[model samples]
Target: MLIFLQERRLPLSLCGWQMRNRLIYLPISSITEWFAIPMVNLRVISLAAPFVLCTSLFALSLVQAQSLPTKKKSDISAPAPQAKTVSLSNIPHAVATAFCETYPNAALVSATWVERNAETCIKLHTSEGTKTRDLLYRLSGELIEMAETISPIALPEAVKETIHEEFSRAEILSAKRLVSAAPTLYEVTLSFGAEKETLIYDAKGVLVRKVEHLPRAVQKAFEAQYPRAEILAFSKQDEDGFVRWVIESREGQSHREIVYAETGEVVAISERLFPIDLPEAIKETLAESFSGSTLITAKRLTQVQYHISVSDSSGNTMLALDATGKLLDMDAQSEHVLLSLATSPAPSQDLKAEEDAIAPIPVALPDPEVDLAVALKPIKVEEPLAAIAAEKKERPVIIVRRYYAPSLGWIPPIMRLWRPSWWW
Candidate 1:
């Protein structure tokens, strides 16, 4: 610290130092009394006078300039926290405007707010026909990515071939394509026995990774229940904590979906049974009605209802039946089901050729703004639209009951003479 001694008029020799300037270099420790300028005893002042000097010529440069160093540039690795979700009304005008300008017709199914690397993003789920697309946008309303559902069959030939060769026994249950700033990849879920495996494949069809595993007990139970049936597919029902296993035995026609609890207990069972699984009574009833006929296939609609397709020398016939093995008339509305199955071609015996041509069916893509109400809807909720036209041709049967007058069996003499073969 620098301080000026108070005895300015004193001669330098009397002050004990002949300094050019009356400044003193005192250690911060000895400067308590010098904080306030005051008259000091000459004897006391003179004792410290020998240290005086001009600060500008000496101490000024000794005081080092100190400040915090500029903070290092931010790390690219630390991702930003996710953005908070807000109501549609809370969306920024710029973002909303950009979205509207880009996808004017998008039918919004849902939306969410997310942040990546400090950038505010709006993720939207827009329904287009039977497909839903996920759209990502920046705060400025710039479209970042537009990812829609893509059928596995629509994947590049290389990708499909790779999957088929690698998992030939595994059937693809669902697939989706993600197109972002990076290279495109397909996410596919395949069913192998009771296990569902998910894999990511590059555009060229290289496998990237697998997803997860299930309880061994659950898998064992599924295999046990459907010993002969090939595992068609499987999915987890998170809401109920149950796993659904789709099993099929006869080509791809017979299907059975069994839901098992996490503990391996049966939760529910719904199977599409073939003709061979029909109750004895039901089989006998069909035999009596359509003699010398072969059962081609049978679809069990419920515990009691069945749609039986039989082929006789004349042609194929469809029979509706109840659980008690009694014939039931098809409902007027369900008449189309019979008509469709009747006209549908029977499965070709050349399974190898049919299997070779298996392809993924793509969902119809519609404009974002199009209304789903105007889209073609299935008249039968239980029937898949894709297979309806195919099923219509080969499985034909409309059993219309023919009512006959009771007196015709023992026709009155007068009526017998006039009765024609068709009339009687």
Candidate 2:
């Protein structure tokens, strides 16, 4: 069969398979057969054919070389990466609070986004509070432009474009340096373990705050970190020059207060609650749970109202107390939860756009005691300090506690603890 196929012009079908796979094969032994046809008159034909064949082969070689491996490019010269862009710039409520508290100058006084025929003017705060300005700019990558009083710097576009093209840098490292030197108004936010720290800046390129977010997850995880310490309240202190935070903790037989500087690091001292006079069992529990604190406050948390406050280097914890001395819940976090719980009866399904539209403009937020010293004035004390000191000395040294469980947001304490009363 092989001899028959080879001898009688039999088709071996080599070209058929070769065409399917697009592979070409050259036979070295066959070259001489074509030359044999040429000897008859073929000086010109022979010379031209050899040159043409060689040129075709050279062309094939070029194509094959192009099909193989490629060269490496230096990523070092590439542009910095950008964040996943978002349209709505929702400044966190906490960040808003912190901004207003720390640098009242940079606060957003009012925001008006024209909706329909009427301009919807949302006043950030009323009653001569913080001064604020909001601005818009065209931003690309790390380069920001179109600056108003509140906008970032305005440089020539060519300079900026040249910088972008020629300047290769680790944007992350650059950001770290910038953040270390000053706070950034991030295009987005970040969540750390149980807490969410959202960073924001003012027009002056100053970090306004690492605004803390307390989610349910954070509150629940709080116990795991400090098993003995209970967070009586999370405070947002609006100092004249800086923002501060304090965590009120209770330990066995004593209470401790830990204050954090603006950077969220403890800048001050940890005070111990002193001269414990609570029931022995309560004292023992406190001793087991907390170190005593110098600062203390009486809090009166009734179903209606409560004021949970923690003091400072003043060496006093002055909280208002009712007959049964249960600590009050007057901090922003508590008030937020209460207000939410109170209005939650009407579900989202019941809410309509028309109803929201018809709703009256929201009342301005009362200033946070937060900066209570600035926002509220201390009542005039006519009594002499000696007498006041005597009264405080005679009063029982007790740190009152109030437990808040979201499950029981609607329930009030059935009974209260009793303590010695003072003659106001």
Query: Estimated TM-score per prediction?
Result: 0.29, 0.17
Instruction: Write model 1 residue lDDT over 1-424, tens digit each, in one string.
Output: 5545544665454225565436656554355554443434533465434445454535654554334344555554333543342244545567678766866765664454543465646666665555657778876677788767777788889888998898889998778888888888788888999878888888888887665455677778776766666553355545333243222222233455455556666654555444677899998889899988865334443233568988789987889753334465667637758877888888777986888799658799886786677676656555576578778777889999999655666765555654667883
How much is 188 displaced in model 1, in angstroms?
1.3
Query: Lowest lDDT 10-mer window, candidate 2?
Result: 138-147
Model 2, range 237-285, lDDT digits (tens) per residue? Answer: 5545455555555544334444444443443334332334345776666
Candidate 1, position 72, lDDT: 54
Q: How does residue 222 of candidate 1 score in lDDT? A: 70
Count clashing residue pairs per candidate: 13, 28
Prediction 2 global C-alpha lDDT? 0.41
Q: Evaluated with lDDT, which candidate comes out highest? A: 1
Residue 178 alpha-carbon offset, candidate 1, angstroms: 1.0
